[model samples]
Target: MPVREMKIDDLPQVLQIQKALAFQDWNERQFIAEITANYALCVVYVAAALHTPILGYAIFHLMGPDSELLSIATNDSHQRAGIGTALLNAGIAHLDFENGDKIFLEVREGNTKARRFYEKHGFEPYAERKKYYADGENAILYVKAT
Candidate 1:
């Protein structure tokens, strides 16, 4: 249950977790970009076993006082095991909250489980973006303030 900064060499296992999840479509190139971005916070939840090195991943971008949680997910086989929570808590702790930073994230309108998860972590739903996704589902925006 150790969370650490994501490394390029971990992409294969990370991609496998991403492919098993439904929300994120980010490819290897995108992950590489994030890992290299100065303002991006990308982390992975890892296991000791070599066969399943990564169990979850979280990506965030920080801009001055605003931070955005771009994506976070746990492998299907690892779901309900607190990996997601560990990833999210680590990401939030990285944000510059002392300066009154606020974190933002969006969830698909129909994703009740995700909404609940965010809410449980103290994110409050504030707004909605219509037809935000290609599938035309509204995006519910949630925010957490320092």
Candidate 2:
């Protein structure tokens, strides 16, 4: 698992994964903006020996001691192979290096598997936003103290 800063060339593969796994898809401009934002960090996980295909990606923003995990997703074909875990670990390490004290993210209330995964990774339920998604699903917020 090679997790590194996302490059412009990786956006295509990243968009593919996002379209498959994300609740809302972001366009190339959004991805580029996040990657270039001063307060943001964007990374991609490449699994092949040649590092050609991106398996997953994470976008986070750091503000003082707080960090927000904006998005994270793995390719549908590469799920369960630890790519998501690796990308998360990398994001955590980056945030810790930046002296961040906590990280937060939101998941759909109906996404039990994602909530379970976050729980297993030391994230605890913190709050909820009713009718947060476009489909009217509630959003469950999870927080982790780093």
Task: Find the candidate with the highest lDDT and give its number.
Answer: 1
lDDT value, candidate 1, whole model: 0.89
Candidate 1, residues 53-145, lDDT tens digits: the string is: 788899999886888999998888878889889999898777747756799999999998889889989999999999999989999999998
Which of the numbered candidates is closest to the native, going by highest TM-score? 1
Task: List, residue by residue over 1-146, the lDDT tens digit for candidate 2.
Answer: 49999988899888888887766678999999998899998999887665547888898898768788888888787777888788889988877644338899999999886788789899999899999998899999998886
Candidate 1 deviant stretches above 4 angstroms: none
> CA lDDT, every prediction?
0.89, 0.85
Candidate 1 clashes: the total is 0
Lowest summed lDDT across 10 adjacent residues in model 2 is found at 92-101
Reference-based lDDT, residue 29, model 2:
97
